[model samples]
Target: MSKSVLVVLSEYGYWAEELVGPLEALDEAGYRVDFATPTGKRPVPIGVSLDPEYVDPPLGRSVTTAEMADKGRRLDASSRLDDPINLAAWLPDRPYRSEPDFLRRQEEYFRALAAELSKADRYDALLIVGGSGPIVDLANNGRLHELILHFYRTGKPIAAECYGVACLAFARDQENRRSIIDGKHVTGHCIEYDYKDGTGFEGTDFVIGPPPYPLEYILRDATGPDGAYIGNFGRETSVIVDYPFITGRSTPDSRLTGDKLVEVLDKGLRTWGFVPRTGVVAPEPAAAGDR
Candidate 1:
């Protein structure tokens, strides 16, 4: 039987191509992909063909019209969340959103999701697809931390793209702290792109660009030592591979990111000689430091 791959989404309306691009690749590789969200129902791909501007440039050349047509059909069909496994139950409402507080809730959510993952023995890897909505869900949700922890512990490959990488924020190490992303190489929507076009939709100062709200800066701040030179950051070109965890900058990097994820899963499964349990050591922290 083909290996099972779990794909998680935040909301119904995300960039359609991000999920579709990778799903197609994994499917072609003989992997059975199961979609999930905070709720088990079908998620809405926020950016669809209706917006010509957001159509991925690469899709024009590599993605066929027939494929997109099928995707549109499937997308339309997923509106009701037919069989969702509720993510809300697994995750906690922020204890204090005002204080950047999600500690207690995350612990609760993570444990529940971890339990579910343990029962899904068929899955060999976890793929977190990204879209604009991640800013609203995947980035800081504690339950996602639990999800990441379970997969990471089980020696399964944990892959994400664009904002999906934000899920890494809540991931804890042996010391039970944040996983640092500095010097390890990572990418996502840049501050410039967010501010350039995402402001009105995301709201003023909603993003981390312009003068420091961009994800890069946020990640930089979150990872490096206190007062570390945040200005000396790079790794911004996307395509950061740390093994067991693969991340991309934006939608454009989805194909490569997905392909890499498959490669890692294939290798990880083959190397273990058996499925790895939860809590397997992932790639060494991007940098060894307090998170």
Candidate 2:
């Protein structure tokens, strides 16, 4: 049977390469992918990501090749992303205790939540595409947290790249109030790659100077004492796969993240990047042409 993946995108603006890299790998692996957004709106790639000649502000160089830029534009214009599932509408709404129907509504909400979470059975894995956009929306979304928790509880592979990894850091069990990644090894956008200024978001007038929060610090704290956060800055691409949780450091790690997720689903591979009790040995870098 062909595996299916549920891919969530940020409404503001997703990095073209981040979405395309994993998606291309998934497609090559014969996986069916579905797209979803917080409000059901079709997500768009950051305009600059489609320009092969556009220099990344932080990197001070053109990271997107012409071929990759073309591919990204094609995917953005494809019908596949035309109508994404509205995650907010699909998931149950939270009820306030102060409401008159608090008791009854809370019961109803739980029932709906259970029903919605059961839908995870249809997917072999879940992926949250990353970009600065995710920092604005996907990171702290309650609905996204519930979705991640559902996948976690069901033992389905959960993959995230770049800033999308923030969601994993913040996804915690309601009862214990502990991060789902509390004791899991992972990687995300390290401090070294963070843009110094000119952080922009779609559908907003403000262009922030710096990211709202430092992902490295958040990931370090969220992983707790038992868990490890591997930055792998300026080294080989960083993609960590510790069972159900798979995380990628940044744009360069996107394809590897997808490849590892495929390995987890197809070959039953359980561990990569960092292993507990044993020290980490960095894997040989991918071939130059592979990027």
Candidate 3:
């Protein structure tokens, strides 16, 4: 049977390669891919992501390849994105605590969620493509959290890159409401790669501030005590495969992230990248004295 993947995209804007990379790999592998959006709108690439001449502030070079730019444009114009699964319509909503009959409604909501999660059976894995847009709608999305949990609970791989990985950190257990990634190894956009200015989502006009939060800081806190967040600072690429979770640091790791996910599915790949307590250490914070 051909494998199927459920790919979630942010409606505001997704990094061009973040979606294109894995998409090409998945297509080459002959996998059936489906799309979903928070509100059923077709996802567009963040403008700069498709511009080959845009120099990345951190990398100090153009990250977008001309080929990638063309691919992104053609894909955006294609009809494949015409109709995405409407997350709001497809998933169950949680009732507010102050709503009438809160207890009954909450229970019903959960019951409905359980039924909705059953749809994960149609997929072999989950991929959340990333960009600044995810901050607007995909992260902290309760409906999406439930979907991520479903794939996780069923032993299926869940891959996320850049800001999309934030969803994994927030996809908590309903009862504990704690991050599922608390004890898992993962990677995401590190502080060093965060833009110093002009962080914005395509869906909104608030376009001149840095990302509201540094993903590296959140990943560090989320994977505390037992787990580790590997940023691989100064490395050209960072993609961690810790069984059910496959995480990529940013756009540079996009294609590799997809290739790793393919290995996880095709060859039973279990663990890759940093081994804790084996002389491996996460990047350290500088002391005030060091400055």
Candidate 4:
């Protein structure tokens, strides 16, 4: 049976390579990919991600190659992103405590959520694309939090790249309010990658100078004392697979992240990107064209 993946993207803006990389990998693996957005809007790639001449500040090089830029533009123009699943309508929202009949509404909310989550069974994996857009839409999104929690609880592979990884840290059990990745190895956008200025997403009038928050710090804390956040600093790219969760560090790790997720599905890969479960410092795996 061909496996299917439920991919969640930010409507405001998603990094071009972040989607193209993993998407191509998944397509090559013959997996059916479905897309979902917070409000069912067509997601657009950030302008910089499609600009081949735009050099990445931290990397000091052009991360988007001409070929990759074309691919990104083609993908954006295609019908793949059309009619994305509307998360707001598909998932149930928790009731406010002050609402009338709060107790009954709360119970109903949970029941409805259980039913909606059952839809996750249709997918073998879930992916959250990364970009500055996620900070505005995907992060701290209650509906998305529930969906991520559902995928984790079911043992389905959950893949997140860049800022999308923030959703994983935010998706915690209501009772404990602890991060779902509380004791799981993961990686995300490090502090150094924060843009010095003009950090913006689509459908926005203004840009937040630098990322509003540091994802590295949040991941470090979310991992708790036992679980470690592997920044893999100085590496060309970073992709870590710790059981059902596979995380990528940034734009460069996009395709690699998709490849690791495929390994987790096809080869039952459970652990990687760590030295004997240590915090990090793993060697970079050779990419397809590297050799």
Per-candidate Cα lDDT values, in order, are 0.58, 0.88, 0.88, 0.90
Q: Distance (Å) between predicted and true CA of 209, model 2? A: 0.7
lDDT of 4 by residue, 81-163 (tens): 99999999999878899999999999899999999889878999999999999999999899999999888888899999999
**Which candidate model has the greater TM-score, 2 or 3?**
2
C-alpha-based local distance difference test score of model 1 = 0.58
| Pairs with steric clashes in candidate 3 | none
**Tens digit of per-residue lDDT, candidate 3, span 1-291:** 999999999998999999999899899999999999998998899999999999998778898999999999999999988899999999988888999999999889988988888877999999999999999899989899989988988899999999999999999987887788887899999988989988877867888667998899899889877888888887677888888999998987888888889999999998877665442643432321121
Regions of candidate 3 where Cα sits further than 4 Å from its true position? 276-291
For candidate 2, the per-residue lDDT at 36 reads 95
Report residue 88 deviation for candidate 3 (angstroms): 0.4
Between candidates 2 and 4, the TM-score winner: 4
True-vs-predicted CA distance for residue 35, candidate 4, Å: 0.1
> Candidate 3 — worst ten consecutive residues by lDDT sum?
282-291
**Minimal lDDT window, size 10, model 2:** 281-290
Provide the lDDT at 196 for model 4: 88
**What tens-digit string does per-residue lDDT give for candidate 2 at 128-207?**
99988998889999899999999999889999998999999888886799999887889999998888888888777678
TM-score of each prediction: 0.67, 0.95, 0.94, 0.97
What does each candidate score in C-alpha RMSD?
9.2, 1.7, 5.3, 1.4
